[model samples]
Target: MKFKVDRAPLLRALSHVNGVAEKRNTIPILANVLLEHDGETLRLTATDMEIAVVEEIPSTATRAGAVTIPAAVLFEIVRKLPDGAEIEFNQESAEEPLHLRAGRYATSLNVLPVDDFPAMVAGDLPHHFTIQAGELRTLIDRTRFAMSNEETRYYLNGIYLHVVLEGKKNYLRAVATDGHRLAKVDTEAPLGVKSMPGIIVPRKTVTEVRKLLDNDGADVEVALSETRIQFRIGSILLTSKLVDGTFPEYSRVIPQNNSRILRVSKQDLAAAVGRVAAISQERSRPIKLTVTKNHLTLSAISPDQGIAQEELDENSVSYDSDDVEIGFQARYLTDITDQIDAEAEFALADSSSPTLIRDTEQPAVLYVLMPIRV
Candidate 1:
């Protein structure tokens, strides 16, 4: 295939695939990207059997043809090229190697027949939804930190995305957990997803799509089927396989009715945990939060560094009991607090129990942090 393209657009498209392509694959063709030139536009496609991406960019075409080239090598070459240089690619005759030229520089790369490249059928994802790009970014940011990293329990390695009705109104809820802590965020369900089944989006896909959401105002076209999902925005298309196992019924984990409550500023709570977490090492990191009446006291005790404490000014807050001390991974507590976008909120339940965190002004999101005993 023969076509010429600008360095910037090609580089941007390849960067997304570079992360998805596994270094070790049974088939070498899986390691390469299929490039098809159809006179006016060039299509770049990559897949690892689980997810696939296809992006089309405007190009100057010579003779129409297609080939498979190592995605990483092509990306690196174009990325390092001097700016504003028009790239010319040609495979004029099957007898010759693929030729690349820009200015006085030239390189030849071995090519494979494009027909051998694997085919990716997107499936019939008839249900398509449109959501604000920035809103999707928020859903991912608030909950992704809690997704399970353990691979053995493959079901928990993704964010659970589904439609929910709270107070008899529709909303989109994202929930993630790693057995230690859990994060759940609720936003108004985008216009078209009210009836779609709840789906688990894999962690890898989440990380990739998050990067694409940079253009906050961009609208995302999302589609879902039984086995695969398609996310489209402008010229970008990301297709990924959904997890096969059933997601644990998360509702059982949420506290039904908890009476204990403590309202504290998110900023202050985050700072307090971060400060005391300095000496927490390994699994025992900064581990204590003691709440009494309107006064909040944070402390951490470590065998190596001993103990430390900090006090916060009191609010009108009152507790259901005398005093409660809860130990948490200083990092986990800090992370949970960072998800809260409110100044004042409550931490429900006792130090020995799972705590529910809520924002007084914004009740849509609920955060749960499992207490770690020191």
Candidate 2:
């Protein structure tokens, strides 16, 4: 195989494909990337069994052939090469090392037989739809933080994506929870998605797909089956296996009739929480919130260190309900507040029940947080 390509495009393609290839692999071929040239364009593919990424770049190929080379090694070499340099790749046979050449640098990489690379067969995908990049980004950014890392409840380790029907309107929803906190966000459902089955998109797949949606104006084509999902972004394609588990009915956990209401500036609340949480030594970093008629106080204490408190009066917060005191993890509070734009609304029942939080600027997103003992 022989081909010539510009450094910038080749480096970009390698970087994307290399992420799917694991550094340490029990099978030798799983650590390598398959490169195929068809005398016009070059195709690069890498897979880790669960997920696969494939990208095609325009190239000038003198011969049509294919080979597999170490993914990490090839990526590093291309990334370090001089920008705008024209790179040449050549190989006489599968048994020979692949030769690479730039302006003043030359090297050869050990090649594995292309036949040894396993192909990830994407079986028939019946459901097809398209989504705007910006909408997809919103759905993922708002909910991924709450995804569970605990392996015991594998169902909560991913974002649950499903279609919700209300009368004649259809909404696409994404929900994630780690038992202590939950995030739910929704957007208008695209056409042809109403009949699709609910699927749990694994955490790793969510992360990789998010990286590809850099251009908000671009449209992403999605096709899926019960077991697998595929995303086509420009010239790149990503296929991943859906998490094999049933997500719990999340609506039962959401609070319905919380009477107390408090509205506060997102920036002010986040800053005060950070200041008080700095003094706490506990792993949970519990912070106490005391809300009275129109005043709010945030405090944290540690037996060995000290106590820190910050107060926000009626000018900074708007509250008219009865006094209430609640404790919550500092990290959880910050995570939910980060998604809010200007103001955050808290609907509370008491210090014992779960508190519902919402972004005042966005009505379709909501969060539920369980209190921690102070």
Candidate 3:
């Protein structure tokens, strides 16, 4: 196998696949990247059984062949080479180690048989659609923070992607929750996904897919089956196995009628909560919000340290309710508010009930936070 690739462009492609390769693998081939050259373009693939990422880059291939090399080692070598250096890869035979040459730097890496690299097979994926990369990124960014990390409830470990109808108008929705807080964001339904099944996209897949959608005007082609999902972004393709579990009926958990309303500046509320929570205990980090007719008081107390209190005025605050005090974990509030760039509306039924929060500017995204005992 022989090919010549530019250092900078090749490095970027390698970086994308490196994260998919398992760092510690009982199967030796899974830790390496599969490199195949067909005399014009070189294809690089890495996988960890659950998720697979493949990227193709233009290269000058003298001999069309394939080999598997240590992903980390190859990426590191390419990254350290001079900016404009051209990297040459040569593997004379299956038994010989792969040789790499760039400028005055040269080294050989042990190669694994390409046949051992697992091949990702996608059965018939009938549901096909296309979405703007920027729009998809926005939906994922708004909801991923609430995805659960608990392995026992594996269903909650990723974002739930599905299509839904809002007052007879169709929309694509992404919902995620960890039993503490929930985030739900929606976008106008894409062209051909009306019949797409609701799939649990594992946390790792969501993260890797987000990296590919950073380009604003790019269009991402999406294909799905009952058990897998595939995303094609430019010359890169990502395939992930869907989590084989049923997500809870999330709509039941969302409160529909919360009468009390509190509106405040996202920046002001976030800053106040951050300052007061400094003195909160490291474990629970509980903070209290006392709401009156026109004022809101944020306070937190740490048994070992001290208590902190701050009052935010009515400059960007408005409410229509009697006196109500609610306790919440400081971290949850900050996480929810960080995603909003404008004012936030908080609707509550009582101190014990779940509070619904939404962005005043973008109403399609909503959050639900369960109150905690302080």
- Choose the strongest candidate by lDDT: 2
Candidate 2, residue 347: how far the Cα is off, in Å: 0.7
Candidate 1 local Cα displacement, residue 320, angstroms: 7.8
Model 2 stretches with alpha carbons more than 4 Å out = none
Least accurate 10 contiguous residues by lDDT in model 3: 313-322
- TM-scores of the models, in the order given: 0.92, 0.97, 0.97
Candidate 2, residue 374: how far the Cα is off, in Å: 1.0
lDDT tens string, model 1, 219-292?
Answer: 99999976788999789899999988778888777776667678877777787777777765766484676777
Which runs in model 1 stand beyond 4 Å of their true positions? Answer: 94-96, 283-286, 315-321, 342-344
Error of 1 at 145 (Å): 1.0
Q: How displaced is residue 35 in candidate 2, in Å? A: 1.0
